[model samples]
Target chain A: MHIVVCIKQVPDSAQIRVHPVTNTIMRQGVPTIINPYDLFALEEALRLRDKMGGKVTVLTMGPPMADESLRKALGLGADAAVLLTDRFFAGSDTLATSYALAAGIRKIGEEEPVDIVFTGKQTIDGDTAQVGPGIAKRLGLNQLTYVAAIRSLDLENRSIVVERRAEGGVQVLSTGLPCLITMLEGTNTLRRGAMDDMFRASRATIATWSAQQAGVDDIALCGLRGSPTVVKKVFAPQPRKEKAKMVETAGKSDAEIAQATLDTLFSANPKLETDLRKLAAAS
Target chain B: AKKELSEHFKTYKDVWVFIEMERGKVHTVSWELLGEGRKLADKLGVQLAAVILGPPGNDLKQAISDAWSYGADLAYVVSEPLLKDYRNEPYSKALTDLVNTHKPEILLLGASTLGRDLAGSVATTLKTGLTADCTELAIDDDRCLAATRPTFGGTLLCTIFTLNFRPQMATIRPRVMAMPERRDAKPGRVIEFKLSMVEDDIVTKILDFVPDTSTEEAHLAYADIVVAGGLGMGNPGNFRLITDLAAVLGAEYGGSRPTIQKGWISADRQIGQTGKTIRPKLYIAAGISGAIQHRVGVEGADMILAINTDANAPIFEFAHYGLVGDATRILPALTKAFEARLAVRRMAS
Candidate 1:
């Protein structure tokens, strides 16, 4: 079993603060972390490799700085890390990004027969869960998305069964191998690397592949030119002008305060009482 | 460079909305898209069509009539057993085959779980662009579809244009578009099609379906009132306050993404761009600092009341009402208040 997990380096969204005066994104002092979602994917891959002997290779496509993310995956017990970086891959949207990653995965397959590919359900920044399916389509791999758990994997039969999350229920699905899986978030807790694993990860020789090395032959299909959808504009959301109307709870107990607040709310918005009454009757 | 539609692509006409149905009922988002698609079709001087794929039954027939009432001029029906359960392979193949044969210029689908799963594969197989979770859709001056969605963690909105693609594709999240009035219109022209694939061809099979056990199955998108918590709740134990308040008000309860990550709430209860988009009459958010992700989900509420310890929580900026206090204490008080008020009203009546 040879598993390839795709990861990304993203600015810590929690730390990203909007400027007070300008209301613009404050990118300064925002540290980059290996996308938190991808950690779950890496952990799942490592668990699979531990059960069934195989090499887990981590792959990412970004600037040279993205190597840090790959190294972090290595520290978490992945066997190898590959970075696909080049100016040609810059300004790539999800489509172009999937194309580059697919090309990189094909090149990795030459070294060993790849059996499975893993990716986070989505990136925190892009918030688009398109790349995983796009890669699966490009490679013609069976896509098992929003997988909650791997019920079983029969390597001998080249098959696997997973619990896929869907609307209203969970579908127990079985599919063939050489497939792509995007594990849902919070499915498993990522493990901490042992002391020795961290040392080995620091010494690991990372493989760096340029666009040509990654088998991307068409220049037009590698960057902005390959992206059909263009973002016309970007702007901050406008704030509503009205501030909250505070309920005067002065010298009142919790119950009195609660009653007072409701009185004021109902008085100001009389329709609320009628709506709630109708809902109560219907229920 | 000004590009013209290729002669082969220029033949593509009509706007199509994929009517997402399961069991017997149609998803409301499908009707919402039809309402939006009708406008686009009218602007382009083309016909509006609805695509229905399900098992052969009266349910399919009812869906076709509902589509006409919602604004569809034509209906494309593919009744096959292979498409009954929505296996991605057969559905994508079937939808793609219909697109290739009929050549609809614009395609819209609900951004539900089934729609997202099918749209990705179909768009990729057809080598076209698909904008997911769109908040707005319109035809630009160039007669091209402009699909707008939040990007960069919902901080900014971006309009995506599929300039080179023949059949532009987009998925709109539920409640993003208002439902159109269902009119009493004549039945649409039905065009039946056949799917080539069979059960044996699909690699993936649904062995069993485990229904969710939790009783909080009220459709969050259509809820009348909502109460959501955020990381400010401090820990999982405090989430019960949200549910207690919701119980008194007959409102649905949810939380921010972090609450789901912390295992305080289930993914289904997450109120954000990634989870459920809600448009309730009254939304009470406690301990929520209101990130763009959470804001977009509840922004459509008719009235927003935010309670937080921090005076400068971003939620207060957009919220109609703000309370600068701890949610732990405030939630229980609010719950008791609403409960007492209701009890009094019941006694008086």
Candidate 2:
């Protein structure tokens, strides 16, 4: 079984800050890491590969610097890594992105048949969660998204069962092999790489593919020109009129301060006190 | 004020909202989108329509009627056995067929798991643009759909427009918009469509469905009051203080993303841009630094109270009230205060 896991290199969103005066994202000092959601997908792929005796190849579409993320995936026991990078791929939206990635996957499939494809539930930067399904549609593969767990897999029968998270319930779905899955976050933890694997990752040569090398025949569908959605404008959300009103607690005990705070809250919205009483009583 | 439309997009009209239903109950986000779609349709001088796809049953009929009552001027429904449960293949094919035949200018769907799965496939098949998790939607000066969504993890908001696409599509999370007031409106027109594909064409099959039986599931999005903690809560043991305070107020409890990463709280109970968006009457955030991601999720609350030891935490910038102290101590104190106050009320009543 050849399993391909698609990952993305995204800015560490936790450390990202907006400029107070300009209202622009401060991307200069923000460090980049593998998108957190994708790690779960990669780990699940590695585990499946370990059990089923197969290969796991990490795939990413980004600038040249994304090679670091691919290397990190290799260090975590992936067999190989592919970086799909090109100047024409800049400003690609989810639709254009999935198109290029699908082309690359097709190229990979030509080398060796891919039985399964994995991606994160969503990326932190875009938070769109569209590309996974987009790739599935383009490739005509069965799409299973938001998968919480893989219950069973039969290689001879070429069937897999997964527990997919739906609204308020979990759907146990069975599908044929060569399907695409977007793994949910918090489903699995990434394993620590061995020292030898880390050393190998440092020296491994990643296969870098341009748009053409990835079998993208249509240049029109490669970048900004191919994207249908246009960003008309970007700005910061309007700040509230005033900062939080501090409850003075310098000399007061914790209990006293708590009572004072409740008094202030109730006084500000008189109906809230009665509402809270009813809610508390019911509970 | 409308701009000249291209020849390809000239015939596309009306704003469509996909009414999502599962287990015989319609998701509330469908009605919220209908409420929003009405405003956009009225602005563009077009009709508001709801698109429903499911098996033929009373549940589907109720959804159609509810769509009209909520604000849909008309509804397009496709009922077939293949659509009984939301398998991507049949649902996307049915929806895509309807969109092709009707040619809607704008399509809105909830950003739920099923909706996202269907929307992505349908939009890709149609080769159109889809913006996910849009916070705001409006008719622009040129009469295009302007979908505003948080980007770069809620630090900035970008307005996206699908100019060349005939059917502009977008998804919004549940509770992001106010629930529309249901009214006694006349039943809208229903246009029924037929699915030509059979079950054999589908590859994926549903083996079983496990409904969430745990009564303790977090209903954070629709909670009246909410209490959340962050890494500053120190450890998983201290995270219980949030639950304790919430219990006293009869509020739902959640945590920041970091807390979820640390296993202090379940992923479903995470309150941030990538988690759940909540709009409660009152939201009390404890020990959270209030990153923009977390701020956007809870900013819709009517009142926000932030408690932290750091007086300069970003949460205080927008929170309605601030308590500069350790949440470990303040949470228990607040819990006691509420408990006593409620006991006094209970005795009086």
Q: Tell me, by TM-score, which candidate is best.
A: 2
Misplaced by over 4 Å in model 1 are: A17-29, B231-237, B343-349
Give lDDT per model, in order.
0.87, 0.92
lDDT per residue for candidate 1 within A164-245, as digits (tens), equals 9877788999999899999988889999998788998899889999999999878788777777667665556666767777
lDDT per residue for candidate 2 within A1-283, as digits (tens), equals 9999999999998787778877677889789999999999999999999999989999999999999999999999999999999999999999999999999999999989999999999998988999999999999989999999999989889999999999888999999988999999878878999899899999999999999999999989988877888877778888888999999999999999999999989899988888899889888
Interface RMSD of the candidates, in order:
2.1, 2.0
Tens digit of lDDT per residue, candidate 1, span B1-349? 2367788888988999999987667999999999999999999999999999999889988999899999999999999877777678888889999999999989999988788888888887777778888998999998899889986677767778888876888899999898899999998799999998888989999899987898676487889999899999999999999998988888889999889878898778889877789999899999999888898998888888888888888888888777777789889999887776676776677
Error of 1 at A179 (Å): 0.7
Residues B1-349 of candidate 2: C-alpha lDDT, one tens digit per residue = 1235688788999999999988788888899999999999999999999999998999999999899899999999998877888899999998999999999999999999989999999999999999999999999877899999998888889899999887999999988998899999999899999997999999899999998885556478889999999999999999889999999999999999899888888778989798899998999999999988899999889999999999999999999999999889989999999999988987898
On the 0 to 100 scale, the lDDT of residue A116 in model 2 is 94
Q: What is the Å distance of residue A280 in model 1 from its true position?
A: 2.3
Residues forming the 10-long window of minimal summed lDDT in candidate 1 chain B: B1-10
Fnat for candidate 1 (0 to 1): 0.64
Q: Evaluate model 1: give its lDDT.
A: 0.87
Instruction: For candidate 1, give the lDDT of residue B309.
Output: 85
CAPRI class of candidate 1: medium
Count of backbone clashes, every candidate in sequence: 2, 0
